[model samples]
Target chain A: MSPAEIQQSQNNQLKFLDKPLQADATTDIIYMMCPMHLLTIEEQVREIKAGQVLSILTDYDGALDDIPAWCRKTGNEFLGIYEDTDHYKFYIRKKAPDNKQNV
Target chain B: MKTIYMDHVATNPLHPEVLDAMMPYFREIFGNPQSIYEPGIRAKEAVENARASTAALINAKPKEIIFTSSGAEANNFALKGIAYASRNKGTHIIVSKIEHHSVLNPARFLEKSGFAVTYVPVDKYGTVDPDDVKKAITKETILISVIHASPEIGTIQPVDEIGRIAAEKGIVFHVDAVASAGNIPVDVRSLNVDLLTFAAHQFYGPKGAGALYVKEGTRIVPLIYGGIQEGGRRAGTENVPAIVGMGKAAEIAKRDMQKRIEHVTPLRDRIIDSALKIDKVTLTGHPERRLPGHASFVVEYIEGEAMLLLLAGKGIYSASGSACSSKALKASPVLISIGIPAHLAQGSVVFTLGEGTTGEDIDYFNETFPQVIGRLREISPYAKGWEGAEDPTCTVKK
Candidate 1:
């Protein structure tokens, strides 16, 4: 895809990520173009749901380490990170005793 | 403690000579410049002498210089003052898209005041086309203001050519030289500009110090109203110490203009040449025409704040990205204007070298930066699956 087209698709995926999400859904995703350095961990924590399997897409930044550490602290499982042309798609299974969905 | 400062475009540390010149104004030379007393006379003479020195640096006469609180303030005075005074002549003004916030904000304010403004666009190298400028002028267009140099991208505008166009059209022209004044030679007469703006702190003078040069015949309404000061053009108690320091800074700049350019240009080139060896990093400004001490670039798969923070941790100081105000981290207008994808624009970093910058400093940065990038990229969502991604380069002027 063209770079602009790639960005558009990335943005479309990000829009999908920000939807009114549910923890019961199999997997929901978000593309966060905002830099983690500009954000506090508290801000990052607030973006998560307790029992959701989420894929948060962000650019190259501290969020890679930060999100995993947040997952570790809250007992969530980081499903590992995936990359496309210009963005990173991070997958995580939110912390819940009964949460098991991963992709 | 050794700290490498590469953010000189934002502000210059006060030169020791400037400080030495200013010290007496705070102590033995303390006097209200308006008073008739000996101390006051001396103070007034100092202020006038400083005005002469500042005027000399820009090839303006002493009568043309009006001291102000800062470059931003000088910009406001030039734009708004001209707008209000020339409203009867015309309500139209033109400025470029890549001007500093000071110029952009005042233009915006004018828009709300029944004045019409056309924002001229720049090319991929952050340059305004003189032909585009000539095309934008209307019969009602009374003024045109363009920046001499863009701090975010280190792009120097064609000021002399733009000045020629303005002179032919009989429109008042203003150049914001805050970014170019000390690091390069800016001769007002040669540029043929009617008004110009500059800040002291951009050239190793104190903060809250700036100057506006108004040509003899051009009329502008005063931005401030009060007792007689600055020939009834700008009103306030003269900032004696800061103004004196600016004068000293101007004199030093004029004296060392060639020498300093020779010293800083090579260092700037070395940094740019070394940094570009990294993958997917593109230089943002004009390669040949940029300021002597200025360099800028946008790196793929990274954001500016992260890069800046990492660089800072290594004892290097610089700026990342451009925001209109401190609150916004949105993609920079300058970068976007240059046709970089909005997402890629966030990766912008600006490095402005100055007097104390050294080769060893650039070496340390060159060595440390890639490691930090590697560390950050390893965890980056963008880089995670970025193997074999399409070329991020857009149709930018190289």
Candidate 2:
């Protein structure tokens, strides 16, 4: 394909999230776009202990260093990361278990 | 995912015309410009012609232009050469706080060598006052090096006024015009600069090629010493191909500068306008007296790195103030010097437009940025409860 055709195809691929998932009081997820988003680890942990999962979309450039470190420190289960041209999609599951751990 | 390059200040892709002009030198005309043969003489002529082209773009004589490997090397040559040559007159040098690392790092190197350096502060708009510059000057002050326009903030300094002051004092004045050259009109004579440095890659020329304009009769020593090249001011074999490209790029810039300025200015303003519509977004640097192709803003409560990532993901390539100064960990000294709070400085993004930028690119950024910022803010702890506070200006509704 020509450069213009390649660009057109790339643009056509970047659709927004069709429907954002809902966050109940007990089940929450934090979605963010950068490694600096991991700076709010304490707040994210607070929500996670209350049975929340945090998902972050980050740029691939610097995020490679920050997000895994955040998950390691916070004990949050890093779900996965997906990267498109310039942006990223990240998902993390909360560490907190059910009633036994809560009690 | 169509990439839109908006980081012209960092570097520019080589222009096709410039690349074409440079091709023969690399392959067919591969003789060293310094040799004595006919092919070498032809290569030498190409280098001289390139020198003249670079000189014409900045209103300097061809004889006054010295080609260098990079802007940093040119700056080092200007600072250390003048300091060493004129050390009998003085050891004190004056520079603005908002200078690029190329200028500032060299000043620091001079300071370590027992040269007393005075850093003049800038106002909230990132402009240094001429009066302050004059006041900073003393009998021992030998050189006043300032940046023509900051690469990070895009604020154009009052170099003409500062140059006038330096001239009256008979002190050597140098301006790092790497960020301003080709993007804006720069006449070394009008600015009364004794020395000026600019890089080729910043203006769609090849990298590893730049020029330093040394005003006629300015006394300076060579930064490099080896074979006689660059009029014996800079020594070493010339990168003939890159120099040819730089020369061609300069010719094009000289012809099309006004039109290029007209084309990029509105795109810059549009980006700024779109950014301002989002709540808590503060435009950094001088509003009117700034680089026409530069737009920078600090988005409160959002991390700049994250925003850059999101923007990059969207195929919008730009820079964050935080990442640019990643080694320092401190926010950009330019942003901090201009009185932008550290937190806000961490959230600053710089978008620099160039010749190839289009209205479609601007429209895409305008449409997508707000949504990304809104989405990111929703997950930020600092951004929580920010929406309904008395600080209505700080929050953007989805």
Candidate 3:
């Protein structure tokens, strides 16, 4: 997505956090060690495909804000964010505008 | 949690005397300094009293000092204000690459606005060579800014020498003495600087309190133009309590500067000695010319954040020059510029001994530190998984 679209989607994601969340079993878990400024949405979106829940643990503030916005903009579910001592646990589920036909 | 503060260079706890002096201003004399009423007059006097004390610490006249919200603002005023003031005189500014972001950022801002900036490189000791300063100066060079002492590496620049060059060339010189003032002697007249910056918190004063010393007859435009406050140089309602605290802190610092050097030096020596005992450790900055309270080291292989966390677990506070702890996870430019390799810079740790720090605290740190490093190293991922068991891909171990 263009920088402006990504920004608009990010604005929507912060707004989405104020809304309710839903959870499911098809969630994929991963640890993203890169700091937020270095991490890109394209890099994250490429992994989960469409219609899969993604759980990410990251300490970077940019990632905390960016991932939720990316999820909302791409028509995915941002389930919720949880906190740990060293990192924040973010749960995002992908929604299929274009499913790769995975289970 | 155990309280062991090794982060004085970041910000210091307020001196008790400073806190006591500021207490009455919080409630009793809460009137604005700009008001014409009796309370206003009293408040104004309090601010002037602070101005006097802060000025006296640096041997400047009271009228020369401008109260700023923080040292960063003072830095902005010093760099940008002078650049704006001397627009027709010249547009080139020279600064050391290791300056605090406050100084460096303003210089960059001036660059964007058509002013030319030359970032002079530092020697491996992080000390700026006066000869380089002499070489960098050109016909268009209007200003030279260098920190009086670096907080990151604790290398005090030779501002007195640099000031002489700037004066000789008829260019304005500004020095950021935020980290140097409370710990060392910073006489503005002796230094021959056009402008000097100080933050109270660096010297055990309250946060939100800072001062800029502009030498008399120095023509610099005000960054903030509004009210007739700060002698109309900086126009804002003064931070009265913080200003009062800063005054008391400055007064105490001046009175006890020598004694402070006597107290913190031995502990600083011990911390540096103990950290050096660990294998593959290298110290940063000038060995002899560094701040009396500072001891910085880079422990190779392990990341600084992991070591910091492990140290924090034992309640021994420390700061890192490491990239992992930074917002962008980038190695400190100061460390890199000082000739520490990027891989080595990742393990940088800084320990600053404060007024409250004692030999006993140093002992506790020394006793706990080796274990902290060992534990972190065992899990470092760069080190071997187990004894005699190593992967061919583990280049760090190799």
Candidate 4:
């Protein structure tokens, strides 16, 4: 297939895998898929302090240096990360009240 | 919904009539134009007819036309050919700072080969002053090459005035008319150009075909050396089908030039007007003298790649200046040369409309663009202090 055809197929596959979101009061988890470096330190801290777990999906191209540094700076729990074909999914939990001191 | 293609300056879709004229040559009528067979004679006649059509588009004689594979090749031939042919006369050549890579790269190559080149600077609106051209000319200047219209910013150069200056100095004037050929009238006699290059794909014709108009009696060497094709100027078998299509497209453009200009200019204006209404946005290049369907702007504080992605999500296709350059992390040199700051230049986008573009497409862009820019800017740290800051570089003040 042509490059354009392959791009279309990949876009279709991405759309199929992107499940719809439901706003539930019982759960405190928010998901975001963007470049890890795009988020500033302040923005990442604000999201963690909102009493919600944040799951971030990022491409692995240069995330090794950024994600770990972000976790250390914010003192948020870095559950783990898994690599997919061209992207990686990272799970992070909100810090307990004792771990929320400003660094 | 059908895709809205606004990237005509990149390449145009083949005109249906031009394709109809070329279909036969690709199949049963395939023959080398130089052969002695009947099919060969037919192919030769078609090529000659195309030559005439291309020549007429620029008001040049048919014999003066030399077909090439692309605009880059034609530009290479024009610059290298003139530099080699006139090496003894002078080795210095003059060109504008904002020329397309086709002209710029060839000139740079000549520079590396021991030729001296001077790049004339343009104003913030990308207008190359004729006085600068005259002042840059020295006794050792052999050629003065400039773009008729910039492909990226759409500023139409004052070719006629520059032509007069070149004439007084006896310097050979070459205009890269690849961006302006179909949208505007290009009269070689009136422009006084010694050589001109044009690509068919810029005018709703097929890609891989272009023509260089070398005014009669102008002495220039050929870039290729093999068979005696293109009046022994360019060698190798002709691309018959593409040449035929280019010819037909030229004919149609010659006949319908005014109507196409009228149709596209309003769409261009509507898009520009909408863009201007937004805060901290700047239009690049000359306003009144630009191409009819060209609209380029810099939306300050937001990254161009992010804007491009947002527009792509909305099914609105456009191009960022940074994306167009090959492997260059720097912002567009054309934008930078015209005094736009690097931060603002990073937000630049170029939109080129074509024959099929409509008012609805412009409306869609206007409605969708402002919201996207606003969203991207909100997330940007650079945007904090830039609210309502109307820097001199934020708008084209021509």
Candidate 5:
């Protein structure tokens, strides 16, 4: 099942992680807003191989909703978010090529 | 009467190619880049293409450039954005005394907001010493901004050395390259600068277009925070036509910079050599290490405005100090900072060359300028000497 379908079945409860997830790559978009958060994720996700996690750091409050929504839309797995002191670190694992949604 | 424009530093006429590139965007291609439709997509493509060209001129990545309205706006953004973004890391900032008011005013504003700012001193030639920059650093130093060159004096600072010092301490370094970026080769990597400010008009592009080069991974708070434009760092409907013109200008500047420099340097040298022949006309800024197209000096007996008007009458237009300081009729802070007495500072005159500047134009100026000074000095009471004039506190070396 795609991440969106699993998220729907789980009643849309956001998965909050206790410890930050290990990721193959990281990007910081702190203080950047709106589509940048989503656009950066889309761009970074394509670089990592299937099953490799990509971590994004941002301070924009909107990312809390947009990132997970983007994961659901793109069929990528959202590992969860790690709350930093000033910003949030979001982790997402790239889906296998067969299941990856066309960008 | 022939009009000889000697104020390239003030601004430049748009190149024919740049105007041609911008023509379409003013009417038919007028779509919002944020829109999703076909016209909007086309507009977005134009903006991105411009971004690439602008970035290419500076050897920066396309994503690193943020479009702004003018060089002043970019200067303000660099100072305030970095100051606020790095506030949590520290509260102290360092800037040179010779910075443009755009940078200086913002630093002053930051000072009022509880940040400690140290305005570093400059040498008599208006050049900042990198060792002084090193000495001013504190554990709380978060950012250091210095001008790449003085628009008023045309003195180029040792930004590469200052940038290296900033890097050694892991501090964010910003350079106000509005005066020097396209006029000279400015490589962010080679200079070790984290952010740089430049304007299109300084390179024969439209007046309204400018850019800030924010190196990748250098986090900065947005100066204008409404929309998602400029990757969410600067927000407003894009000035599509102006930005397009700037891109074309940048491309042309990159291709023709060496030729332009070669053409202007000799003409500039002639102006400086001729002007310095008149007694009491002292050169400002570093003689050999200055902008290739710049010639600036202080005429002892005549006021700069008087020289400007008399020269304008003779069809040779020039400026006195910066556009702002000249109009204020006060001694230019840059002159005062460099230890020129206030009386001498009033006589500051600047002549900058451009692509259109010709040998004939320089010859005309060379003959006319001395005549205008002579005329101003003849009618002046102090032409003989400043009998009761305030002490000539000038620290300039003979």
Candidate 6:
């Protein structure tokens, strides 16, 4: 499938949270567009242990679909996103050592 | 004849040590910082090291510093970045009247873009009253930018007090420190600034390198958007050699700032004192609360360019107000802002000393400057009086 089709399917399955969840680490990439949101998530996730949550803040609309799809592809838990005033907070739980899959 | 360079504020000659530090990056270790190979890894390491050293100069964390191409670029980025980033929060911005063109032009640009900009006034000494800044704050105010020191008039603004007021109001504060940083000790923590702009060339580093200190957690929109360079804030291929030179220069500036101040202050004072002895020559900016190496004045009947030309002939290179005002042949707005008459503003002359400046250079400058003024005034049409043009008009020929 094309990237747009995959994003469409991923958007349908996105979980929205009413409130912010606890995260072991947080990286604010607000106003940074495109691949930065995804690249930052991958870089920040590696620093946290399995079952630890990494929160990414971004203003990019593409992250609404890309992050969740990224979690699905990498076998990590895609936690719900909390919508803020001007941006979104995406939470991802790092997978256990054995459960982690190569992208 | 021996040449003496007194235009340090315009740009400093690159220190030999800085050039030596930057040499390897231009040739053998030339690699894109984003690559994962050996050359690239070395390049990345060098860039990070430079970032750390640059950050250390201002007592900021490495992650908070974003490299730009020049001080003007950094200033533009700070103003436009913060203005755009906080537009949703508020649309009001405040800047001092004596700011550099980089700051003033950006503020003017923002004004045209539906943002409200309040240009706060300065005193006769070109000092911005913190009280005036406090009074200008409105509910819509989201950012306050002020120059740390005026390159034209040599006046240092009370940015710490303004920073306090901004902090109390929860407004983002940015300072254009292109003229002050590296010459003076700048501590971001003590200054209470959210963003500060400075350049490498001002501190004996190569041109085409500058940095903006964005306090951690401050959200700013990208000024140049292309890659993830500079942490996606300022994206362009890093000028590795220039950045390395900047790092070395910053390290040296931090190490030798106090000694430099001690070295140049006396010579600068000598220039000011000698110039003030001439009839109709008035010192500009605060007498004591100014940059250590900076001395500026307005000579009553002569034009700054004529003085600059005559002085250049004597093998003494100096500046006539800021580079913009000098090239444009206009009375500096900074001089006018400080209550100098428009005719007098045309006579604005600025001399900035550096580590290389000696007592003998000051002696030569002091002797030649008064002679230059006398010769210009001898031929000046305004020498007799401004009887017909006594009004504070801005036109030079009027």
Ranking by lDDT: 5, 6, 1, 3, 2, 4
Docking level of model 2: incorrect
Task: Considering the two chains of model 5, state its CAPRI-style docking category.
Answer: medium
lDDT of 2 at B105: 79
Q: Which lDDT tens digits does candidate 5 get at residues B1-398?
A: 88999999999999999999999999999999999998899999999999999999999999999999999999999999999999999999999988898998899999999899999999999999999999999999999999999988999999999999999999999999998988899899999999999999999999999999999999899999888899888999999999999999999999999999999999999999999898889999999889999999999987899999988998888899865557666677789899988888889999999999999999999899889999999998789998877644333211
Q: What range of 10 consecutive residues in model 5 chain A has the weakest lDDT sum?
A: A6-15
What overall lDDT goes with each candidate model?
0.80, 0.80, 0.80, 0.79, 0.90, 0.89
Alpha carbon deviation, residue B45, candidate 2 (Å): 0.5
Q: Which tens-of-lDDT digit does each residue in A9-44 have in candidate 3? A: 554454323432343332211222233212333445
DockQ of 3: 0.01
Summarize candidate 4's per-residue lDDT along B308-380 as a digit string, tens digits.
7888888877787533342354667788789987667778888899889988888888898999999998899
Scored by lDDT, the top model is 5
Candidate 6 or 2, higher DockQ: 6
After TM-score superposition, what is the CA distance of residue B34 in candidate 3 from its true location, in Å? 1.3
TM-score, every prediction: 0.76, 0.76, 0.76, 0.76, 0.94, 0.95
Off by over 4 Å in 4: A1-103, B322-327, B386-398
Model 3 quality (TM-score) = 0.76
Local accuracy of candidate 3 as per-residue lDDT tens digits, B215-317: 9768667788666677556877888999999999999999999999999999999988888898877888889999999998888768788888888889888
Better of 4 and 5 by lDDT: 5
Tens digit of per-residue lDDT, candidate 6, span B1-398: 99999999989999999999999999999998999999999999999999999999999999999999999999999999999999998999999888888888889899899999999999999999999999999999999999998887777888898999999999999999999889898889999999999999999999999999999999999989989898888788889999999999999999999999999999998988898899999999999999999998888988888888888899999888865468776667888888887777888888999999999888888889888888888998888998775554544220
